[model samples]
Target chain A: MEKKYEFLEHTADAKFRAYGKNLQEAFANAAIAMTNIMFDTEKIKPLLNRAVDIKGDDLKSLLVNFLSEFVYLLDAEGFILGRIASLTINKTSQGYRLAAIAKGDKYSDKYETMGDVKAVTYAEMEIREEDKGKCWVQVVVDI
Target chain B: MPKRTELLKELFEEVPSGVGKGGITKLTKEELLDLLEKGSEWSLENGYGTKADLEATEESGRMKQADSRQVSERALARGKPQLGTLGAGNHFLEIQRIDEIYDEEAAGVLGLEKGKITVMIHCGSRGLGHQIASDYIEKMEKKYGYSHLPDRELVNAPLDSELGQQYFKAMCAGMNYAFANRQMIVHWVRESFRKVMGTSEGMSQVYDVCHNIAKIENHKVDGEPKKLCVHRKGATRAFGPGHEEMPEKYRKIGQPVLIPGSMGTASYVLLGTRKAEELSFSSSAHGAGRALSRAAAIRQFRGEQVARELMAQGIEVKAASWKGIAEEAVPSYKDIDEVINTTVKSGIGKAVARLKPIGVVKG
Candidate 1:
């Protein structure tokens, strides 16, 4: 069993790593990890579902876009989150495309939100493959 | 600043429906691109702020190198609705009173007097700027794979490279967006005051400066004039008196450096010094650097408790999210006094006045 996600220490920003058996799982966990920057996922409920479609030129770009879309939704549209329900990635001639369904609801006073995530940064963002076909994605978010 | 409770209540509590989400003026793709290209000039043309406000801003609130073509659709979309908003996280708008004056002459020059009320705003270019940075970092990393880079975040492109130019251009545009965004917010703040208090008293931009930016400048190196790209990250440019970049009114004195403290701490206004040009490349620390991480702060303190403590100190706290208050607690930041002392001792900045918060609005 792989760890879903864990926090890492950074001097000025919030850093984290998400682990999974494949890239897609790692990507999904990464989204949840970013959401964790704002709300403690355990307390939030999936009441509003938002579909996300993003195109990027590479795997790294795809992951960044996937996470950034969630940040935008939360900031611009007030779509708070419990989790990402379904996420899929496909290769394209340009590079890679991602489709994800984020399940969450408008922020209410009932749930516990620790902080607001301002943006997902490229600071130390990476995707790596491990032994036995495991994948790990790392990101640092600016709060 | 007084008798404006009703308007303040509405402005602080919710975004007006006509102003779009977050109480910001929404923009179409074209308008946003134009804004990216023109910056504060676009805001001024649209009647958001006055010419004096732009003069107080860095580069007169426009960076001519900005190229909207380099900006992406996602970046545009993310920034479209956020214009004029006081963005979330540690960003805030605060009402303060001048507490102490260190240099009476400099304080007078800056229009600050003891017990005088002032409004200070802290924010950034929002999602568009972040997205631009992300997009460029990826492009730079791919072009020059970061095999030798010690930290992945420190990815760089050669200053003369095509990709580097593109990044610089996009970054300038983002800087412009931030300028216009802040200008519009200032406009709204004045309106809110006028609508409720029947006056826009004590609402003015003292000096607006960018802490994170790279500018091509000529500085003396080894007694020879050399062109350098000065990048000030987590730092403020402290141009001394007589510098060409200084606005006409400020040229005889020095650039006004606004250093804001964390909640419950004292903020300072410092004058850029000539010694800074010799010692620090005309740069100074932006604020008190973080003493703890957000998680550490959350673990150690509660937002409601912090709010109560601030209220006890006669500081009003209004927040879109209380958790934000906890993450940015006073304990989470370094001592502003020590930071200012270090800055002054280093000969980079000269203390002019100190400000204590009376009211704060955080998102």
Candidate 2:
């Protein structure tokens, strides 16, 4: 089976490339990759769900806002991401909007912590459908 | 020996550290706003630290320009829950023993005695500051698209413009949040000492400085005094002696510059020099800057093996997870002694004392 994401080299932060057959799947996998950086997402049981609704000026901006939402959720409310059940990106007259339903549990001792993703950056962010029906997203996050 | 281990455990527990660990203080949205305005002065009023602590902190623990009203609701929410936390990722609470004193006069003035223990806490505004930076960065990018810029991260507004002023105010608020956060952690460290060694007295604060932030300051350019907005990103203040803004007690010795090494390495204290202001805008290296990526660190070192080696050297390490240990291996960073030596050789900084970590609590 092909991997969902792979960690990349970064001098002082975490960088990764998430892959999927489509943009939505690629984004969902990106969330998982970022959460896995904080803790093992496989150990997170989907005890609750959160509806993430955010908008941005463009696709790249949308990507940063989308990933940063998870950082905010974990810090503001003790919620960690286990999986992304659904995600959709829409192009509006102005820019874009993203809606996602993320399933996860309240943080607990059962989950092992590696580190926290503090913020998402545009340093080396990319959104591309390189091959036909093949999508990949690259992100550099400040840890 | 037991006391050392107990101190680490107690600190690790009292001051929450690691991923998913919330702050110890639970503040309402209103209280969070107040904190953003007052900074460490808020900590003093709330019975956490002392007035002297505020005196020793960068910007006196409060940025005068900070207006909490400029802070966004999202930033407020993110900062409210984690008021006193040492967030994960290179943030740490270390108990170090001062081992070498290079400048006896400066060390004596700073009260850094050889072989005495000192605590060092490295962290920032947590989610609040992060959210603030992201929020404004997005705001800037939205107003002015990054297509023409060198990098999207460079999307910025003119400092005199409304959007830029708003960001400056919000950034100051976030800086205040970081100040209060460190003050609260200092209280917890004192409590840990009391719980473990039965005495919390005589733990006078040395000094605290802010890096990775911007400041509006007065500097001399070509022998003329000018006010400049100094952005010390990934650099710390090394203010020279007799700066009017510094605390009076050490006005003759200069401000203390803290440069932390990587885990399991020697950290240094250097006196800020007038040459620093003239040569480098009074800024010094923040830490032993990362030389290797974290992914490489993890692939090359196991957490257990790393901990075992540090333990073999008589250093006690306690962390939220083994992954944290592996990711912050000492080899992953450049040599601190070399960095400080370069700073000293540049005449912008003078070595005061060298500190070796005896215990660490990773957040």
Candidate 3:
């Protein structure tokens, strides 16, 4: 799927703008924008592979747990994910379960820390899929 | 947003708030200065806490470069007697339980075994910090002309300017005051728990951080590393592993980022990432941003109802007023999970554990 992305400044923080034909593609693009904030996306290579699974009751919570788990993989295991191989998400009795495979490099000095995001906040968050197969989400990253 | 009227009502009744609602103890300027210079150390010296508590605090609960003289008399006066007090509006002291552990290793380091009780304090320099910001922002607005600036709220003064330095010093002093305030309150909280449970040995500082103010930091912007006076009004620093600022024990695990939710919701403890510096100057979200305005919140919910609901959920709440409780109701704020997700996706912080509130005290 083809996608477009941009970074928008809201208040003291920034939010990623993603446009795609499906929810998965939009999420993938948003993830790319998030990583691109740290390093040049083109410079990262898929050198190692890993899988992640997250569960939440709602779409918002599912998205948060998914991203949080992904970042944990990179920080704890030194894995810089370059690609989302596959993702499967479904509702469960508890909330939602998401399983994903990602591939990327170990580390690179070429990247820089932009701002210290303390954690994801539950403020001014939204995810919408347009009628024309376009999807977008706005999240406020704590910095 | 929680109904502002309801929150105000509950807050006014239960929590000791306002400009001059003194706590059980008061402090003098000299004592306040000591708190500013020493941070939690002074509180410990005064028998508020022990040495082990300091290890869990960020920067050992003190910013070394803070110059107290830069603090104005006005700021000092505001801080005096305000030390050891919890200020109003979103600032709180919550007794929470480690409801879930995502990373056992990090959770172990934080001294969290499932069901363990922890006290989370959410506050800043109180009136002193607010006064400093008010004074400086006024000066900067006059000098820079707010309408002409890129962002009206981004009024700034040069880092080396007299006013700038003074604000920094005063802000640091306020930070110290907050640290001392939390420390003193931690002592009281222990006392309170001891009175109820007949034990005081288990409580300890997991982490303490500031959500507002600015600091001079070294970061690589572009390709060269440079010093910049980073202003984090509603943000918290999330320094990655191996940074000099981190405690030696936490260096390998990254700095602890405490994100407290509203009265009955779940809070989070996250860790910093090296990738954070590139994403946000090594900063992250402070809390669940207000989804509803205070006024709107007060109009929508009743403090008594909110309190009752929370109590039914097994959460004990104490507030200065019922209206205040309404203003801080869970529905008044955004979903915390979303905020955490953005940070993780942005590669700024990683979640270590989720905390569920058991008891709360609001100012």
Candidate 4:
């Protein structure tokens, strides 16, 4: 499915708007948007492979944890997951669990740091379905 | 919509606010840093509060891995004298009453009952934090020419850059200073209350959280778990139940989310939910988003009239500048209730209790 992503400016921060035909596509696009904020997307290559699992009670929280974890991977391990191989989300009695594999090359050049996100906040967050058979999520990282 | 003039008038009179305003206590630089890193723990150690106070604080009043040496001497100097002082705008020490309980179980656990008086302290690293941000921004802008960046406001340096690390360390120290400052103020507030009521009945900290700051953490994104730095400006973390950070007592309920409203309105206490993990990096809004600019507020309201209105509502206020008062009128902010509602509706947090102001002290 085709997807579109846009960057929105916040007070000393940046937010991304991702639209896709399904949740997975939207999330993938969102990942692209976030990494693009730090470096040129075209320069990044799909080299290394990594997998992640996240749990949350709702889509919004899960999205935040997902993005945060991605950023963490880049900052701590210097690994960037440039491609989404497969993604699956399941709803459990406790919450939602997400499992997926990402592929990307390791960051070599000292990546510029944008802002240190202290923690994800609950303020002004929204996730909704668009008129097209697509889903949208608007998230504001604390940084 | 409420008239901005009337709103400004009411806010000026009820909420204590201003810049460079001193609070009831003073402290030295060393003393302030101790508070900064130690947070409420310093207060407890100094006999200003009890151990129970730490339980109510985020991170239990201590942030590990803070590199105080990274703090600049100038930043330290700026923070030294400001310790124990509430240096103005939006910073306040309010004495309030638990006028309502939204979730009885949560309120009971929080040790709050209707009619119980509570004190809320709102301030940050003050000059120290401001100086750190300023110094880093200038250095980064000069080197990176971030002015040409897509968003000039998002100016920053590489994470491993000397400037970046220094800012992080200094910022942590500043946070520590804030923790200590609020702890000291809590001590004074207790003393003042004891004096006013002629009783030694001590008060405890409900919770202490920083809304503006950054940190490093581990999370999973797109199924890949990684470590990243999270920065929250005008935001707060709402870690859910069973998280390692949650105090044992609150693990079942989740982390306490303190949401303060405009002076005339009600503040809320909420608990984090697991759902927040997906939504916002387990984050939430800090407060009602500003609805009016300070200049607009000042132009719309008269300070004196605002004070009178608050007094009429039985709320007592002490502020440093009438202009400051006029600028923060309650109407100038988004309805806090709505903001709280959004949080709950989004399933990030659950309402616990509501607090109404009885007395306020602004800087």
Best by TM-score: 2
**Per-prediction DockQ, in order?**
0.38, 0.82, 0.01, 0.01
Put down candidate 3 lDDT per residue, B246-354, tens digits, no spaces. Answer: 7777888898998877788999999999999888999998898888765467578999999999988988777756766887889888899888888888899988999
Docking class of 2: high
Per candidate, chain B TM-score? 0.95, 0.97, 0.90, 0.88
State every prediction's TM-score relative to the real structure.
0.89, 0.98, 0.67, 0.66
lDDT tens per residue, model 1, B1-363: 454346546556532211114444657788989999889999999999888888788889998999999998778877887777776666788878899999988787678999888878888788788888878887887899776977767889998899999999999999999888888877877877777667876565788876688888878888788899999988989989999987777888898999999989889999899889888889899888899888788778998999999988978777756778888889999999999999999889989999999788776
Candidate 2: residue pairs that collide: B18-B363
lDDT of 2 by residue, B1-363 (tens): 458987898998999873565776767777888888999999989989988888778778999899898888888888887888898789999999999999988898888999999899999898889888888887887787778988988888988999999999999999999998899999999999998999899998899766888888899899999998888888888889999878787789998988899779989999899988988899888889999899999999998999999998878889988888999999999988899889999898899999999999997
Query: Model 4, A85-111: lDDT tens per residue?
Result: 878878999879989898878765333
Candidate 2's C-alpha runs over 4 A off are none
Candidate 3 lDDT by residue in tens digits, A1-143? 35467766453344667766776766666666666544455677877777777766577767655665444444334355577778777778887887878777775444332212223433455789889777887665432
- 1 against 2, candidate with superior lDDT: 2
Give the alpha carbon lDDT tens digit for every residue of A66-139 in model 1: 88788777656767767878888999898998888888887655655455566676677889988897999999
lDDT of 4 by residue, B1-363 (tens): 113233323333333221222233456667655666666677678777667767777777777656677666656655654556554556666667788888888788778898887777887766567656655655675577653666544678878888777777777767777777676666666655554455537465667777678878766688788887888878898888888876767877788888888777778888888889778888888777778755466568876777778777877666655655665577878899899989999998888888887666655
TM-score ranking, best first: 2, 1, 3, 4
For all candidates in order, state the fraction of native interface contacts they contain: 0.29, 0.83, 0.00, 0.00
lDDT of 3 at B343: 84
On a 0 to 100 scale, what is the lDDT of residue A57 in model 2?
A: 76
